[model samples]
Target chain A: MTDEQRRRRGRPRSEQAHDAVLAAARELLAEVGYARLTIEGVAARAGVGKTTIYRWWSSKAELVAEILYRPISIEEIPESGSPRDDLAANIRLIVEPFTDPWYGPALTGARNDLNADPEGQKAFQAQIMSGRRDTGRAVFQRLVDAGDLPPDTDVDYLIDVMSGLLVYRGAIWRQPITEEDVRKLVALLVDGRPPRRTPS
Target chain B: MTDEQRRRRGRPRSEQAHDAVLAAARELLAEVGYARLTIEGVAARAGVGKTTIYRWWSSKAELVAEILYRPISIEEIPESGSPRDDLAANIRLIVEPFTDPWYGPALTGARNDLNADPEGQKAFQAQIMSGRRDTGRAVFQRLVDAGDLPPDTDVDYLIDVMSGLLVYRGAIWRQPITEEDVRKLVALLVDGRPPRRTPS
Candidate 1:
């Protein structure tokens, strides 16, 4: 094969198309919500053929999931610091995307669409939560190594409870989970002590 | 006007149509879920015209909400017993609808639909949770009166944590919040005591 042909084959139009598709998806999701969004619309918005979108993301849910969660990687949460401090920071980072003006509405829309179908919700969680859980596992392991947590503390259950608390408040009650609440929750679970009664 | 005409005016076909509409909606919701349900479908299934449904209910959301949650009145949870036992029982009762085979699927579908639209979610929560919160308020007040909870215990926050834990486990994790889990949570928060660790 010629050198030019080999180079062209290695770096195809797929890369540029991938970025454009994702960008268009993010913008359109914020505007329309998942219920009204269609793959055709996404393709048109991205200035790509429908075949190009289909080549990468098989479905709208898959594309939207990637768009909302692409920024959340295990490395974003550092586990080397004090366990409580690290946990608090890590949680803040995890929630940052959900609080973003652009990402928040899109995610809410995407989530509602995914949630309606049980199968879609399962797949989305498996794809997104697996990496997030690994990060949480690392923090728990660090806490164990530092003797900040009980040796046999169930890491997965603890993570579930912590995140569940935040999500429940945000989604169900539409209430903002304050940093103070996070701090208290972490401290209480770790220390097993209720704060001394403050005069009301 | 004739007495019969006056009686018909006072108690129109809306009375019978209301019951039939709710029943059919509940059945269809479980069968096809909220995403697939439609007013026309429910009306057809109930053997009633669309006008009857529209007259009694402004929208499908209002009708569905009433059908699934009509049973969750404040007095349904009895408060005659000890606070801890009563609280646990009340929690179990509160979750009963979500766990029922018939009602659970419908509520899940309804929730997914409501959660996507911010305005709809707000109205549903306000209309539904207002009464539910009253029941919770009664339970907390009883606990406080009986000295089961500390005077300075942030009741609202505590309740949020408790329900959030359950919801997180149920909605996000898709895990059952078992009776034992509820009991342990209630006990742990009330006692503020960490479990004794078994030697590994």
Candidate 2:
């Protein structure tokens, strides 16, 4: 091959290896679930060396986190007139994917796995969490622009509390956050209303 | 041995075995952590049969959960006159232990492990979570009775949200819930106030 072609070969070959490793990791994750899946297995399946996988991802948890960090785009959030409905819908949209029969267990399983790997968790927070927060910022900003939330709303803190509620309920508790619960959270956090008893 | 003596021996022997297993499990957890700890190790350490351990606890997760479920008694909650301070203190009392360097990783690790064992999770919920909720109820009720929280407030839902925040922040995010954050949560949940910008 010509020198020019040989030089060009390196970039695409590395890209191909990257895609192959991710695809193999995803497939194996689905096949074996997170507990049984391993870096060695991903390497062997992807036809890459263990170091290649390790170079990109610190552990199976990080690998799985990348696979699961598909953010809900701005377009996905519904444009209902009421901001409360929109906000609650946005929350469900972001969190409900975790409740899927396939994703729920896998997500929680991977989350727990991440706890053991602090470096991987930091990488995940830097990359995946920051991306997720950006999406939250956009959604909350829309509410502010529309005069739904007060101008002085602490969006960052809101994001943190909302995120905590979502993960704590959906992933940790292993239960669906009901519509009433969503309404209560939004009302309390955004509207600053105490949880009122629903008249029987 | 006399028949009466032999019959009496059975009850004390079983009780001793139970105490021994719990002690062994707690010690082993401190040594190996939740991920590497096993029923076999617990049984061997306790000098009990594996079946004996299994008979009492379904999985290592349940055993660890039991070891970690030491609740703060009502007496432990400080009697600060302000209900909000009392409430925040109560929250810290309940959640801060999990943040113990020795307990934090192990608790999160076991929590994830529990996700894989549904029956164990149910037992944890039924026994541990319910007991926790009861404590929360007492605290909230005391607040209401003190003319602090409104009597119409839903304590159960409050408990859930507070719990979500605690686990989400402490265990999941691996961050200390700051005093400011606690004040905000208490004010927002109890007094219905939006998050205000802290003075720069």
User: Where is model 1 chain A poorest over a 10-residue stretch in terms of lDDT?
Assistant: A191-200
Q: After superposition, how far is residue A101 of candidate 1 from its true place, in Å?
A: 5.2
Tens digits of per-residue lDDT for model 1, B162-200 = 676766666445577776676656665566533323422
Cα lDDT, model 2, residue A38: 89
Go through the candidates in order and give each one's C-alpha lDDT: 0.69, 0.78
Give the CA lDDT, 0 to 100, for residue B177 in model 1. Answer: 70
List ranges where model 2 is wrong by over 4 Å.
A1-32, A37-58, A73-75, A78-83, A142-153, A197-200, B1-28, B38-55, B72-75, B78-81, B146-152
lDDT of 1 by residue, A47-78 (tens): 99999997866668778877766645657766
Model 1: DockQ score: 0.31
lDDT of 2 at A189: 75
Could you tell me the lDDT of residue A173 within candidate 1? 54
| Candidate 2, A132-196: lDDT as tens digits | 78878777877788876777777877777787777767766767887887888888777776675
True-structure lDDT of candidate 1: 0.69
